[model samples]
Target: MNKGYVYFLTNYRRTTIYIGVTNNIHSRVWKHKLGEGSLFTSKYKLTVLIYAEEYDNISDAIAREKQLKNWHKQWKWNLVKQNNPKLEDWYDTLRGW
Candidate 1:
């Protein structure tokens, strides 16, 4: 029974956005930071994790990721702002988790 996560990543300039789902947020994020996650993420340099939501079911996490991907850019940005006003890289916070 693995938990899952839906996360948002943006570049340093916060100009590009990427959304993804994973059963292990830490390792997945680490790969993205190293520019090995996906061609889209690598090309856009979307390494900073700005928002994340946990789910008990991986299917739910995947569904949520799909939903967010279809959302308008402004809507996505607003969602990130609601959860992370500062839009800080959340990788450091994962250390305590």
Candidate 2:
């Protein structure tokens, strides 16, 4: 079975947060960077990936994406801070396929 990823993307100013689920993180992120990923991402120009969670199954990733989406803004920030204290862009860290 294909693995899955639940990830968070934000703008340079950290003004907007976008949660997404994907089977291939690199391809999805690359699309987001190119402004063709989603309407919200394109409208907000969100390309910085701040957080990501990997799962063995796509369904689990989708469920976590839904959960994070329902969280409050600050709560989401705190969660991201826990793993990524600097809140830095994670795009550079993604492995090339």
User: Evaluated with lDDT, which candidate comes out highest?
Assistant: 1
Q: Per-residue lDDT of 1-97 in model 1, one digit per residue for the tens?
A: 7888999999999998899999999999999999999999999999999999999989999999999999999999999999899999999898765
Name the weakest run of 10 consecutive residues (lDDT summed) in model 1.
88-97
Q: What is the C-alpha lDDT of each candidate?
A: 0.94, 0.93
Scored against the true structure, residue 19 in model 1 reaches a CA lDDT of 92
Q: Estimate candidate 2's alpha-carbon lDDT, on a 0 to 1 scale.
A: 0.93
* Cα error of candidate 1 at position 79, Å: 0.6
What's the TM-score of every candidate structure? 0.95, 0.95
Q: In lDDT terms, how accurate is model 1?
A: 0.94
Worst lDDT 10-window in candidate 2: 88-97
